[model samples]
Target: MTEREHSTVVGQLPRTDVSSPLTPAMLTRLVWALWMASLGLLAVGATWTGPGVAVDGLTVLMWVVVTFFSGIVHSYSRRYMAGSDHLGRFFYRLFAFTLVVMTLVAADHVALFALAWLGMGLVMADLIGIVRGWPQARAAGALARRYFVASGALLGAVLALLAWATGETTISGIGAQADALSIPVWAVAVGGLILVAMAQSALLPFHAWLLSSMTAPTPASALMHAGFVNAGGILLLRFAPLVTLDAMAMQILVVVGAISALGGKLLKTVQTDIKRQLGCSTVGQMGFMIMQAGLGFFGAAITHLILHGFFKAYQFLSVGDEIERTQPTTDHESSSMGVAGAVTTGLTALAGGAVFVALTDKGTHFGSGLVLVALVVLTTLHAVRSVVGAASVPAAVRFVAVPLVAVTAIAGYGLAYRAVDVALADLPVVTAPADLTIVHGLVLAAFLAAYLAIERGVYERSEWLYVTLLNATQPDPETLLTSQEEYNEY
Candidate 1:
């Protein structure tokens, strides 16, 4: 068969017919209803506070985000996977994973939370390898299963340690007694939680699973990237009290986050596949979220995750369009700005920074807040430059559009930050800004140097550096397909 014919056959359902009452289309509507209900609950300020189950601002926010993304993925999958095999099983597992994540966020009891966390990983692994005949899909699922199991084990150990030390079975109870815990106990617990976060978020060494998971269907990838990967930041935010106990632990988070962010970004530049590039991008974005938590702004971390979830979900769902758009472009187009364009970009960035500070009240204080503000400003600068340097646009139009877009984008971010900050105000250690240290300066310097190197194409010139990054970004060989013949079920 021709390549096109083979792909068509691979996408076809098995010859043996299977029936189910609950179709993917039905599930899509149900998920959308649930999403709407979550929004209504948030609107009415409904909450439940208890020992075994609790629903507060964080829970409500996550509920809305989770259900919304789940709804979108389900809706997309209905058409995307129409002729594929085991359509019913796929939706079932997807819905189960969504519920598991929702339960995890609302769980107050240590056992319940742990079980939900484990369930999430298991269901996601199942979804990753839903096509039973595909060797690549099975391998990807197995690889991811290992990482998820390791993450769950670490989280379980930490939760057990905290319960043993505090004599509390509930998360709130443990937090209330966090201050009384000894240094050694605090150190071990914080260390374990960080490891759990790292694995779940696919940071650095743990990122291979995500890169190899492209064998899964697009909807599964969308849900995994949009909702599942954000679990690390959610984990850290939920345990903010315990994490903030050790200043040294917080500093360690900063260092680790910086490394992961820079490493992920560098790896993304070398990836030729769209899905792997997105996986690397998630690692970098998660690093920034963790860094926000380390800076004692858990609220900001929450904001970052929510926004990232929406953005990534859309990106994944629109992958077809992305492929079509990029297929015709073989050469890289360099963007440049004249003196007027440069001036416009600089002024727009400054205006964006001012708006951000005015709305969020950041950068006024010393410490990591200043660093966060600078990063935001730099992001604005990059965005404005992209707009102003567009070769097809008229200079007058580019200059006119730069400030408007920058201010609007920054203003939206500021609003989101404020909303999240307000929602999490009642939570302990949610916005505790840490004092600046020499260690932070060193990390910042290293990040800046790496950023400059990438922007200047230093890695492209250095064969060793290019090779290192290429190897670092590659998926596991076991999860790769050598040919269409190897992809038994596509």
Candidate 2:
């Protein structure tokens, strides 16, 4: 061999390392097969039940379509497909559309119940599989994925056994013997499945796995966070009538949703990474969905799910655009707000929260008085901030608006002599006129604060919360299809 050629060969050898074989085609086929099987099951389910024919048919159809979309996602596991971000986006919308269909069809007891058990278990397992096999997935993430798969599989098997033991493979007739059996068998199945699904959805306490799952690819993150993650809540909406059976469970869902929404918003305030912020926001939003389910606001929850899925998908897709723009650049983190603006916002938030807390147990006189005081302070500070910061808008403003309105309305209602139930219809009027006035004023102030935050290059606290909501249960984008040397296949 020539000396120069030998030298070149030796130099190249140190730069290369062996890697796990690329098996995108295999992954694609598996996902495709699973999608087809889910559709087949839906078809079987539709025909197996003789009654509620229309409901069953629609439910089956929706499930089939969603599964197909999920399969398409898996199909794009190939390296060549990774280059086409648009294909990834199309799958995202399909997944979202599936959620919308499921939400609408789940209103039927049988369909809701069947989907809760069979469909949720399958979907969770699918997500776990994809996350586990991701080429660059972390050890902890892979372990978490396996745990989800095991748990989901175990749950599915248990339900299947329960159905068998009762001599009822279909959800329509399993509980027909007992007095309580007057409730459709679907309700029992749906209830059981919804509980498990909520845990998988990461409503609050079961939320750690969701944050960890963020280490996955961005397309995976987009689909899961924007659409797939909400599958549990949608499942719950299907069995809305049954969720009321156990009052404690209903209350728990409500409280979890409340905590997730409020606490998640607070935490999002501090996150530095883009993905983590969105993940936390997702946790909060799902909490809202759960709360709606608890309140028997099935319709509202479904609507929220649809709107959120669309917007969040758009937001995640934009992340890829941001990545491409930033890739060739250096650090560009914006500076924090000036001291005065920060202090004003902090004090306003504290006062708002304090008033709401203080009034929860108090009578009309004290509650109204406190609410009025808090509202005035909040409004004044908000105005001051807006007037001063009209020239330096931040990019995060758009994301934060949704949560700000929600929190403001919640806090406003809490501080008044009114109950702040999530079911929009159930929200009562304020007995105290002062409290009502304060609520109106606070709403205006919230809008002002949001505007000011945007103008001052400051991310509104709610925007941060939204980011957390998006982050909490969503996947990270960078790990999805990067060409960076550090992430490149060997």
Candidate 3:
């Protein structure tokens, strides 16, 4: 290697040395200690069996998820960023972000929660800026910081409204204070919280940060892609009842979320780089989660958040194994099905979903059952297509396997629903208003229209639209994709 190139990579990293105090082992020891403290608190919350500091099912689940995610990413980063000059400092920043996430979820007082929320943004600014030697990384960090400010502002508005309406400074009390508030105050608070949720989660216009985040190490990306990025959905779930009470908030959440989901997913299809693709996918998934939350399907949204977080984290950490995971041969031949497999797949999915819904319907309204059914069918179809796509099974075996897979899937879903149901029972069952039902259809139509436009080259018809989207991701992903050796693989 050339001297200049070696120095370039080293210069791009933070100035730190491997030492006893700065070792990855030492860094993570303290990190794990704090995380274990949270687990102890979790046990206490469970035993209290009464009003406590963010001790409900949702908080407990999130606390555990984030702590474990931190540990996994910490261990992964030990090797992933081992060669970097800033290895020690990187852990410091990453640990700070993870710690802030834990505190935010566990915060009981309104002020403390808000403070923790602000602290997350501050720490993330440092975490994302770890590669300051790269101008592209700096730009991405600045862009993310601006959005973080916007989110903090919105959160501030929400807290002000909450305090004004109920004279309560604790999160638990504010949730309970919902019944005492005037309609106007409640509406304003809910709206603010929705926007805060969107901004924090990088929905659409605020999403360039995720792409820019690729400039950081893969381990930090895993920490983010897995658990940190879901903060918005988590926040919405934290305030699910408030979200459902305001008709305007619900409408805005569904409409904007649908747009983000469609746009983000479409963008993912066009991206060549893995990190950019994953970032776009996260945006779409977060939007879908927001939509689920808006529809008052908090259980499904929480499930989606937890499941997607871990899956994405695995993807980030396993970047070196991508060829094996999606190689389309051997075990990865899932997406290579022919026409017959496709047809059978559709039929099996439909039948399986119908049976699942029929057998498990607890008289759920607002189409919650439909949501669960659609997701189950889609998940089942994908699995069936993958295995059947392998084309190794006899026709008779394939036919019989369909029923077995369907039954197993429904049973698995039943377990998931029960888990989410129990965890979120502390939060009320929120449903969308009847008047907002039409908005749902319009949102879906918009999503379809977007798909068709992108698929049909409608954007190409307009020079500016094409150019804008082509260069849509900010901090110029081109620099990160090319012209930079340090993060190219990432």
Candidate 4:
């Protein structure tokens, strides 16, 4: 059947238009109220002098971010998911997930943290399969649950090991005694935490769960991308002391993160579905966040995740706009840039780099800071490439837009980086940059090669590579909907 016909059939499914006493409007208000409370807490946290485990800047920052995203998702869902079945249940799971995330970030006790982490995974699984009658949703939820369970189990083992080794039940206590632990115990604990972060953030091999989770509603998807996936970065930041104990472990993170970043971007290019494209994008973005943590800049990771949350939330919430396409791009629209455009792009990138270095105080000398600056410059160039290369746009307009966009982006990043750095200052090992090694060099080489190949469309020319990526990105067969009738039966 044609796309329009399928949409018609899907749209014809029964919807409960009759509003209950606890309506979407009511739920929206409730979410806003929670947001307000979180805001107040953030304010109090700024001046909080009392002794507490979870009342630090990191906890309050996360609380505000979670509630803000939750509020946006709820407000969007009120209209986007109107008349949908299980609306109340959706709201319930969403709120629970938000609360669990907040608890996970704020928990100072190892046991409480583990429980909150587990609870988060469970709530997310429920939301993924909110439509019980839909087999695809159920299968998707099951797939995600397996991954999440494994992540939780790894976390449990790590926490138990830390508590046992340090004889400390509290997270801060474990961190205090982490350095005193034996090599084997520390190695195993760190390894487990790495795996937990990998699974939670949907990095590399652990990314299938996220790619297959399209069965979730748009709001859930937003929350998953905006808040849930970010938990990995938060986890890393919270355990920064333990993670930064070993140089090899940090290098491992860099390697894994680089691979996932390149692989996810490649996969995104081949995805036909918009949601799946965004999923692949999240994998790539999360890879960057992990890389930042690996570089001993947990503050940067936090900043990245926060900004990414806002970005992905907007992307998912406004995804309906993607369906309403106008005219397709012609060959002329995809034309290459001229000499003038190239010069402008180069200057814009340079200006972005200077702004980044001046404000963030990175990349002044050699090491990971230099690498970060290079990445930022490349990112700036990429951001403006489309605009500069657009044959339809006037040259003058392209030139003007490139610098304006670059300055804004770089300045914003710099400001956020400073704020996060200060907020996380009380935490140990939050910005311990690892010395560059041969392994890092090799990883950087591979990353650049992948980036070049992607930019040049090498994968498009190589049928083997294209098919490999396409097959690799496919959701599990169990989660696949064979026909509209499968879900339409409800």
lDDT of 4 by residue, 1-490 (tens): 2132224212233366644556667767877887788788766656333222466788888888988999899887776666676877887788778778877877888888899999999999999988888988999999999988888888998999899889998888888898799999999999999999999999989998998899999889999999999999988888888889888998888888888888899999999899999999999999999988887778889999999999999999878666754455553455578798888888988899999999988888667777677778877877787688888887677989667977898999999999888877777667887777887778768877886787689999999999999987999888888898766774
- Top-TM-score candidate index: 1
For residue 392, model 4's alpha carbon misses the true position, in angstroms, by 1.3
Residue range 1-490, candidate 3, lDDT tens digits: 2122222122243234554356677767766776687677655556223333555666777777887888888876776676675676788887778768877877777777788888898778667777767676676677677778777877977887797788887776777777788888887788788778877877887777677777667787778778777888878877765666666676787777777887787677567678778888888888888877766667767777888888899988877544322223454334345787777777888777766666546324555345545556655775576566666677666667765776676666566656766666665553333343667667656755775576466876887765666576544553354555665533
Count clashing residue pairs in model 4.
0
- Superposition TM-score, candidate 3 onto the true structure: 0.81
Off by over 4 Å in 3: 1-17, 20-22, 29-52, 323-342, 355-368, 375-414, 428-436, 444-469, 473-482, 485-490
Residue 29, candidate 3: Cα error in Å is 4.5
- Tell how far residue 292 is off in model 2, in angstroms: 0.6
RMSD vs true structure, all candidates: 3.6, 13.3, 6.2, 3.4
Alpha-carbon deviation at 90 in model 4, angstroms: 1.0
| Candidate 2 minimal-lDDT segment of 10 residues | 6-15
Tens digit per residue, CA lDDT, model 1, 123-205: 99999988878887889899989888878888898999999999999998899999999989999998999999988988877
In candidate 4, position 379 carries an lDDT of 79
TM-score quality measure for candidate 1: 0.93
TM-score per prediction, in order, is 0.93, 0.50, 0.81, 0.93
Ranking according to lDDT, highest score first: 1, 4, 3, 2
**Where is the poorest 10-residue window by lDDT in model 1?**
1-10
